[model samples]
Target: MHFVTGGAFHGKAKWVMKTYSASRNMEGWFNLYEAECPETDQFETSLVVLEGMEQLVKKVVQENKKGTREVLQKKLQSWLEWESDVRGRRLVLIGTDIGKGIVPMEEENRRWRDVSGWFFQDTAMAAERVNIVWYGLEQTIK
Candidate 1:
């Protein structure tokens, strides 16, 4: 699978969409972390481990209260299963602002940075190929 990543405004999303559109593979996953989305932003890398753990706890509780835990888990499981079951080439696009320097802020911003970083790490481990986008340029990180 092809995994693409980059910081904000780096054109990772555009590249991923373009690449996916040009490809013939029908099985692919697009995971995007846009700054506009609070959840995505919360998953950044700037937060400490303890902060991340706390945020995860809060998220679990929030999702559970909304009765969305099962649904989200099921979807994640299905994606993992698909990743394993597919025989032909597969593509997975994961976009984030990884290399962007830490944001100078407290609490919320820090939490977002931490979470985003964790998500990127997990995605990279699961992907076979990893590409980093910077200034609209692409670099292979894995």
Candidate 2:
């Protein structure tokens, strides 16, 4: 797994496209901003790019406050296992960094921020490569 995180409107998406778009067998991007949330069985390409994970975390938190972390962790594990199950398969996750700056006043917003941060930490730990993109620059952190 390759994990990339940075502030919104940073160069994360551009970097991802430039770095991985050469592969002809790569899957159509599963962007949470546009499509329905994807399941493990839905991925069927050599390289899988998943964008807008922070949104998913927010959705999970909103719908299942009691089980948000568990649900996401399970989903993450399933994705990781799926990637490992197939040789030459790759998983790239792109998430906007939402844990920075002034804390939100709303309870739900604060919860979303905390859960998203924790989820990102878990992703970074499992990822083979971790990067932070800022000001159109890429910096590998792990």
Candidate 1 on 72-117: residue-level lDDT in tens? 3443344455545545535354455532686747654554455546
Which lDDT tens digits does candidate 2 get at residues 1-142?
9999999999788899899864323465788887667987888777888889999998999998687888999989998999999899888999999999999999999999999999999999999999999898999899
**Cα RMSD to the true fold for all candidates:** 10.2, 2.0
Q: Could you estimate the TM-score for every candidate? A: 0.56, 0.94
Global lDDT for candidate 2? 0.89
List lDDT for all candidates, in order.
Answer: 0.48, 0.89
What residue pairs clash in candidate 2, if any at all? none
